[model samples]
Each structure stands twice: as C-alpha cells, then as structure tokens.
Target: MKLLIVGATGTLGRQIARHALDKGYNVRCLVRNARKASFLKEWGAELVIGNLCKPETLLPALEGMEAIIDAASARATDAIKQVDWEGKVNLIQAAQKTGVNRYIFFSILNAEKHTDVPLMEIKHCTELFLAESGLNYTILRPSGFMQGLISQYAVPILDNQAVWITGASSAIAYMDTQDMAKFAIRALEVPETKNQTYPVVGTKAWTAEEIIQLCEKLSDKTAKISRIPLGLLRFLRGFTHFFQWTYNISERLAFAEVLASGKALTAPMEQVYEIFGLDSKETTTLESYLKEYFSRILKKLKELDYEKSKSKKKKKTPFKSSV
Candidate 1:
C-alpha cells in the first residue's frame, strides 16, 4: 500500500512510518522540511514538502495516497486552533477529496471526558469530524506513552530531582509507541477496524505513586517527589482560561481536573487485541520498560564516572613517561 504519514517527524509518527515501511508498504512522509526529515528518506520513505497550517499545500501531497496516518498535533509554541482544528479538518477533507482508502487518526484516551483541555477537545472534535467525513477511518485513542515517562519520572528520580505529580490517585495504562504503531499499521489490513475507535493502552495500569516505587526499585535511587494539589491546577486553569495569550499555559493545567476524577486511564484491551490481531502479552510493561531504561542510563553514568576517575588518576600520577 502507498502510505502518506503526516507528522512523520514526531515520536509516534516516525514509529508508524518505520512499521509501515517494514511491512512492505511504500511510505511517503509529508514533512515541512525535507532536509530536516532526510533520515526518513534514508529509511526508504519518500519525503514531500507540506505544512498542515497551509491547507493549500496539502492536496498535492495527499494525491495518489492509498492511506493516511495523521498523528499531527499542536506543539507548545503553536497556536492551538490553527494546527489542531483547522489544519486537521483540511487534511481530512483533502484525503476524502483525493480518494484515500483508509484514514487512521491518533487521539488521546477518553478525550471526550476532558473537553475543557484544548488539545483533548481538539482531538475529540477531529474524531467526530473524521467520522462524519464519509471516509473509511480508524481512530486509535492511545493512553500515555511509556517513552514520555522516561523524562517525567525516570530521569528525575535518577538525577534526584523533584518528580512532580498531582495529588489525584489517577493511574494510566501507558503504551509504548512502537507497540501502538503496530495496532495502527495493522488497522490498515483489518477490515473490522475500519471506522472503529479503540483505546490502545498497555497491559497494566500504573499510578504516580506506583511508578515512583517502581523507579526506586529499579534504579535503587529514591525519588524526591513533589505533589501539586489539584486545587492549584484548577485555580490556574481558571485564571488562564479567559486570556487569549495564555492558551499554552492553560494546556498544562487542563488535564489536572480530568485525571483527578479518581479514574484510571485504561480500558479493556481484549477486544482491541483481537481486532488488531495483536497479543496482549507482547505489549511492553511499565516494569520491564523502566528496568531497561534505568539499566542503560545507570550503566552510562557509571561508565562516565569511571572515565572521570581514570582521568583524575592519570593527572595525579607524575609523568612516568621516559623523558
């Protein structure tokens, strides 16, 4: 299949392109700067110049595409309405106009529950828009990425910095981007997955406290934890909500109340697994993932320490060279 992957430079998008290419699909990455995305070209993907914010530049790129995997979202520096809302709608329209067979959209888990959150609301809206666009679409709503947890929890705990978490008892079934990419590319071949929405989360759900403990066990380093009260997030959201310039700041606090609902961001994966022809056991778990990360980082740190000590010893020793 000829695939057009939008946001191909992003974490999830790159994984999708890799998986699709590996599956013998001809992959074309619609990137803003071909030079910046030259790595995709090296990986056997054809790179095309296109910007989501420029709707006029989308159609020619979408032309002759068999399928589209849209993983694009607004960055912290981007205007929320331009990219997430208008840009996405235009892309969907172009795909429909160009007769793209399958459309796969990556969305957030339980986005409807967080309507006040700018990105979540945009994702939910885009889901609805794609559903109504008269196209064969599959919406994969994945929970948090385990990759993100590396910096959020692992690095901080390892570096002995304050790992911030809300006081809410919220647990998330974080999925690996690589595994999630499998479900996405597999959706192209699964007839039943067309026009269906699946919550593609990990095998196990983990809370903030549980993850901290896991990091502690794996890295053997205690985490200096700081809890931000949900009330404070709510207050900040209210303070920033009405300001036009504070949308970016508001995005940070938007999910605060949603997660505080005492809900686990997880769903039954039995059906999703069966539909996507994926094994639940093969999914990466929080424990194994964290263990691998901490092991690698700690080893690197130890190697650095050894090198530093070795250099110090060399400097301390009088020149033993025959002079």
Candidate 2:
C-alpha cells in the first residue's frame, strides 16, 4: 500500500515511517526540511517537502495515496489548534480531493473524555472534525510516551541526582514509541481499524514515585525525588509560558486532576499484543530502560570529562603558571 506519513521527521513519526517501510509499504514522508528529508531518504522513504500550515502543498504528495498518518504538531493548546486541527482539516480536504481511502491520526489518550484540559480539548475538537469530514478515519489515542519518560524523567535523575515531577501520584500507562508506531502501521493496514478510536498504552502503569524507585534500583544510586504541588506546578507553568514554551495551563491542571483521582490505566495491553502479534507480556520495566539509558549517559559524561582534562592540559603552556 502507498502511505504518506505527515511529521515524518519527528521521533514517533520517523519510527512509524521506518516500520511501514519494513512492512513493505511504499512510504512517503512529508517533511519541512530538506536536510531532515535527506536522512529519511537514506532510510528508504520518498520525501515530500511541505509544511502543515500550507495544505495546498500536501495535495501533490497525498495524491493517489492509500493512507495518511498524521503525527505532526506540538502538545500545546495553540500548536494543537494550528497543526492538529487546522492542518488536519486541510489534510482531510486534500485527501478527499485526491481520492485517499484512509486517514489515521495519532492522538493522546483520554482526549475526548478529558474536556477540562486545553490540549485534550484540541484533540477532542480534531476528532470531532474527522468524524464529520466524510472520510474513513482511525484515531489512535496513545498513552504517555515511554521515550518522554527517558527524556523528561530518567535523564534528570541520571544527570542531576533527582527526578523532579509535577504530578507525583499520577498513574499513566506509557507506551514505547516503537510499539506505538507498530500499532499505527498495523492499524493502517487493517480495514477493521477504520472508523474506530483505539486507546494504546504500555503493558503496565507506573506512578512517579514508583518510576523513581525503579530508576534508583537500576542506576544503583539513591536519587532524590522532589514533588511539586499542583499550585506550584501552575506557577511554574506560568513561568514557562512567559518564555513562550509550548505548555498549556489548563492541560497542567487536568494532569493534576488525573493524579488526584489515582486512576489506573484504561488501555489494555492484550489488545495491543493481539493486534501487533508481539508478546506484549515482555514488559519494559522502568528499571531496565533507565539502567540502559543511564549507562550511556555516564559514558558520555566520562568522555566529556576526558576531553575537558585534555583541553586543560593543552592550555597549560611552559610559561603558564601552575597553581
């Protein structure tokens, strides 16, 4: 099948593109940068240069395509509206005009149910638009990304000896981006997935404290975990907003509410395994992933230290004073 992947340069989008190619689908990547497209070309994907803001540019790339997977946009409210809502609307129009059969979208879990959050609201709105667009559509609402945990949680603990978190007790199902990509690819290939919304998540759920404990066990270091209250997090959100960082206050508040409720994960791993044909039983525990992550980080830090030492020695000339 011929497939066009929007946001193909992003972390998740790239994975989905690669997996689609591996599955023997003809893949076209819609990318904003030619340089980014160069790498994707090396990965065996045809590149189409276009921005999500300009829907007209998408038509040529999307023409005669069997499916379009939208993984673009930031997680913020404004970015979501611009890219997820507007851009997706444009893509739907183009797809209909170009005779595309299926439209698959990557969305966040609980977006429809959680109306109080700005990000979720944007997602909900986009889903509504897709429903009324008269196109065959599948919406995949994936849980928190495991890759995000590595970047947002584990790296901090490894580098700073602590995991500072906004919502401490929130139990979120985290999915490996690779797994999510595989699921998306499978959904695209299967006709049963059309006109459906699937909640995709990892094999298990983990709280912030539990995650930190697991990381500590893996790294064999007692790292501190600092928890910020909802109000304090709200303040920090304001500070981040002042710098124009792409975070929404309402979303943060919604996250706080989720934590306060102490709810378990709603997505089932068995469904993921059944769909993707992987033994989803093999868990990516927080401990195992963090151990591997920190090992590489420590190696890089050591390399940097060696480089710094060598530079210092080189700077110490014969005339230079030895302290």
Candidate 3:
C-alpha cells in the first residue's frame, strides 16, 4: 500500500517512517525542509516536499496515496488550532476530493475532557471534526510521550544536579514513539481500527518522582527532585505567554490546570498491546531511554567544551607577523 507521512522528519515521524519501511510498504514523506527530507530518502522513503500550513502543497503529494498519517501539528494550543485543526480540515477536504480511503490521526489523551488546556481543547476540536468528516479514520490518543519526560528529567540527573518539575506526584502513562508507530502501522492495516479512537500508552505508569529515582539508579548518581509550587507554575505559564504567540492564554491556563489537577493519568497500555501484539519488551523502560538520551546530551556537552578549549588556545597564541 502507498502511504503519505506528514511530519516525517520529527522524532516520532522518523520512527514511523522506519517502521513503515521495515514493513516493506512504499512510503512517501511530506516534509518542509529538503535537508530533513534527504535523511528520509537515505532511509528508503520517497521524499515529497510540502507544507501543512499550505494545503495547496499537499494535494499534489496526496495524489495516488491510499492513506495519510498526520503527525503534523504545533504542540501549543494556538498553533494546534491553526495547524492541527485547520490543517487537518484542509487535508481531509483534499483527501475526500482525491478519494483517499484511510486517515490516521495522532491525538492527545484527555483532549476532550481537558478543556482548560489550550492544546488539548484544540485537539478535541480536531477530533470532533474528524468524527463528523464522513471519512474512514482512526484516532490514537497517546498520553505524554515517554521521550518528553526523559528530556525533561534526565538532563539534570546526568549532570549530577536536581531537576525542578511541576507535578512530581502525578502517575502518568507514557508511551515510546516506537510503540505509537507500531500502533499507527496496525491502524493502517487493520480494518477494525477505522472509525475508532484508541489510547496508546506504555506497559506501566510512573510518577515524576519515581522517574527521577529510576534515573538516579540507572546512572549511579544521587539526584534530587524539587517540585515547583503551583503559584510559581502559574507565573511561569504567564511568562511563557509573553514569548509564545501561538500558545497564549488558553495554553497557559491549561498547563496550570494540568499541574494543579494532575491530569496525566488516563490511558492504559494494555489495549495497544492487545490490538497490535506489541509486547512489553518493545517498550523501553524510562530508565533505559533516559540513559541513552543523557549520553547524547553529555556527548554534545563534551564537544562544546572541546570547541571552547580550541578557541582559548587560539586566543592565547602570540600575534604572528602577518606581513
């Protein structure tokens, strides 16, 4: 089957493309940057340059495509509406016009119920639109991405320092991007998944504090986690508003609510495994993923240090006679 993968250059998108290629499917990646598209080409994917913001660019790419997996969107609420809602609408219209059969959408868990968060609310709107779009569709509402947590928490731990987080006690379900990609591929293959909304998560749930402890154990470092106060979180939310145009009032309010109410725990990982036969072994524990993520960060830090030292040596050199 032929497929079009939007946002194929991103973290999750890259994994999805690799998984699709492994399945021996003909994959076409719709990307904005040619350099990023080249990487997918090296991975054996046909690269198609397009922009989700401009629907006109997508119609040519959508031609002769059987399915479209939309991983494109702005994580902030304001951007979500513009890109997720409006972009999805544009793609659906183009798909309908082009006679595309299936559209797989990546949505966030608790989007409908969590109206206070701007991003979730916008996603909810997109889900609602898809439900009424009169097209065969599958929606996967994944909880917080496991990678997001690792990036947020593991950096400080690896540096032998504490990390400050808002909701340390909330036990949220996290899913690896690989697992989510497997589910997406399954949704593309399984007829039963069409017209349904599935929640994708990991085999277990973990609190932020627990995750911090796990990082400490994995790296053999003693790291403390300090919970930022609600008031401080609210202030930071507002502060972010000044700098973030697409993620303003609603997004800030939603972030504050998530921290205050601990709205992270909602989905279970069992359903994902049951539907796709994706065993728990496929999902790496938080500690394992964090170890690798931290290692990369440390490597970059070392490179930066080397560059600084080279610059210092050059500066220390006596001025040569440059006749």
Candidate 4:
C-alpha cells in the first residue's frame, strides 16, 4: 500500500517512514522544507513540500495517497492553535476530499483526562474531530518517547550539567519511537484496528527521580539537578502570553505544567499488543536502550581522546628522524 507520512522531518515521523519502507510500502513524505528532508528522499521516500498551516498546499500532498500517518505536532516554539488546531482541521478536510484511507493519528496519552491543559485540550479536540470525519482512522496515544529522554535526561547527566526536573512524583511510561512506528505500519494489516484508539506505552512507568538516579549510575557521575515547581510553570504559561514573540513560551509552558502535575501517564498494553499481533518481548526496554546509547557515546569519546593524544605525541617527537 502507498503511504504518506506527515511531519517526516521529525524524530517519530522519520521512524514511521523507515518502518513503512522496510515493510515494502510505497512511502511519501509531506514535508515543509525539501532541503532539510532530503535524507528521507535518499531513504526512498517521495517528498512533497507542504505546510499544515497552509490549506492550499495540502491537496497536492494528499493526492493519490492511500494512507496517512500524521505524526505532525507543534513544537514548543510554535503557535499551538495555528499548527495543532487549525492546521489539523485543514489536514482532515483535505484527507476527506481526497478520499484517503487508513488514517493513523498520533496523540498524547491520557490527553482527554487533562483537557484543562492547553496542549492536551488541543489533542483531545483533534481526536474528536478525526473520529467524526467519517474516515477509516486509528488513533495512537503514545507516552513519552525514549529517544526524547536521551537529550533531556541522559545527555545532561553525561555532561555534568544541571538537569531541570519538576514534580518528583510525576511518573511516565515512555516507549521507544521505533516500537511505536512498528505499531503504526502493522495497524494497516489489521482490519480490527480500524477506528480504534490505543494507548501505546512502555512496560514500566518511572518517576523523574528514578530516571535521574538511573542516569547517574550509568554515567558514573552525579547530576546537578534543578527543580522547577509546577506552580511556577503555570505562572509562566499565563505570563508569557502577554507578548506575540513570547507566545511560543506560553505554548510550551502548558505542556510542562501538565507533565509535571504529579500524574502517571501509563496504560495497560497487553490488549494493545494482542490486537497488533506483536510480542511484548520484542519491545525495547528503557534499560537496554540507555545502556546502548551510553556505550556508543563513551566509545566515541575515548576514540577522540586517543586521537588527540596521538596528535600531541607526534608533534613532540619532531624532525629528528628526517635529520
């Protein structure tokens, strides 16, 4: 089947495109910048320049597409209403007009439960809109991404930098993007998955403190930690909306306020795995993923140090051999 991946330049979107191609599906990417997304082209995906905010450009991207994996999401610095709200409405309309099938939408886990949060409210609204659109749709509500934690927690700990965390009681079941990608492509083959909503999460839920402790053990370095209160984030969310330029700050602050609300973002996955016909053992665990990442990074750092030492030694040995 031919598939189109929206937001193909993003981390999860790229993973979805790769998994789709690996499964022998014709993959096309609806991208905003062809130059930035050139790697997708090299990986055998057809690229079409389009922006979700611009409704006029969506038809061309949606043309002749059999399936759509909408991984497109507003960034922290983006206009949430424009991209996540208005832009999504436009995409749904275009998909309907073009008669697209097998629409897969990625949403946040437990988004409906926290509609008071700005980002969660937007996601919940979009979920309702898509389900009511009369299209064959599957909604995937994924937990925090393991790949994201690498930069947010692991890297900072490795570098001995201050890691900012909030809501020590907050726990999240973070899944690997690659695993989530597998679920998306596999959904196409399962007719029962149509019009279904599944919460895709990891096997275990972990707290912020537990994650930091694990990072410290793996890196063998103590992390400099900075704690931010959820109340402060809530204040910033309202305060930053006063200016146009700072609106981006307000947009992302909503997420911080919600994620740090001492809530657990988790769901039962046995049914999800059974429906998708996947074995639980095949999923990537947080421990294994982090171990591999740290191993690779530490090896590279050692190689760099060895190369620098050799360079200095060569200079010191000098021209005596030539004379």
- Alpha-carbon shift of residue 16 in model 1 (angstroms): 0.7
Question: Model 4 over residues 222-254: C-alpha lDDT tens digits?
Answer: 999899877788788889988889877776777
lDDT of 1 by residue, 210-284 (tens): 999999999888999898888888889889979979977787667666766679999999988987888888988
Q: After superposition, how far is residue 76 of candidate 3 from its true place, in Å?
A: 6.5
The regions of model 4 sitting more than 4 angstroms off are 167-169, 317-323
| Better-scoring candidate (lDDT), 3 or 4 | 4
Better of 1 and 2 by TM-score: 1
Deviation (Å) of 299 in candidate 1: 1.1
The Cα error of candidate 4 at residue 281, in Å, is 0.7
Candidate 1 off by > 4 Å: 316-323
Give the C-alpha miss distance for residue 134 in model 2, angstroms. 2.7
Please report, as a residue range, the 10-residue window in candidate 3 with the lowest summed lDDT: 244-253
Please give, for residues 159-271, the per-residue lDDT of candidate 2 as tens digits: 76566665536688887777778878878767677888888887678887788788777666676777667677656555655654545554555555555455665576676
Reference-based TM-score of each model: 0.95, 0.83, 0.83, 0.95
- Residue pair clashes in candidate 1: none
Give, for candidate 1, the lowest lDDT window spanning 10 residues: 252-261
Question: What tens digits encode model 3's per-residue C-alpha lDDT throughout 1-323?
Answer: 99999888877888899999999989999987888579899989998888777889989999999998988776443365677678778888888888989999998877777776777777888888888888899999877678777557776777756787665356777778987898899998877788999888766678777787787776667887677776767776777767755356647565555745654565655766676666767677666677787677768888999999999887855778788
Worst 10 residues of 4 by lDDT: 314-323
Residue pairs in candidate 4 whose N, alpha carbon or C atoms collide under 3 angstroms: none
Candidates sorted by lDDT, best first: 4, 1, 3, 2
What shift in Å separates residue 109 of candidate 4 from its native position after superposition?
0.7
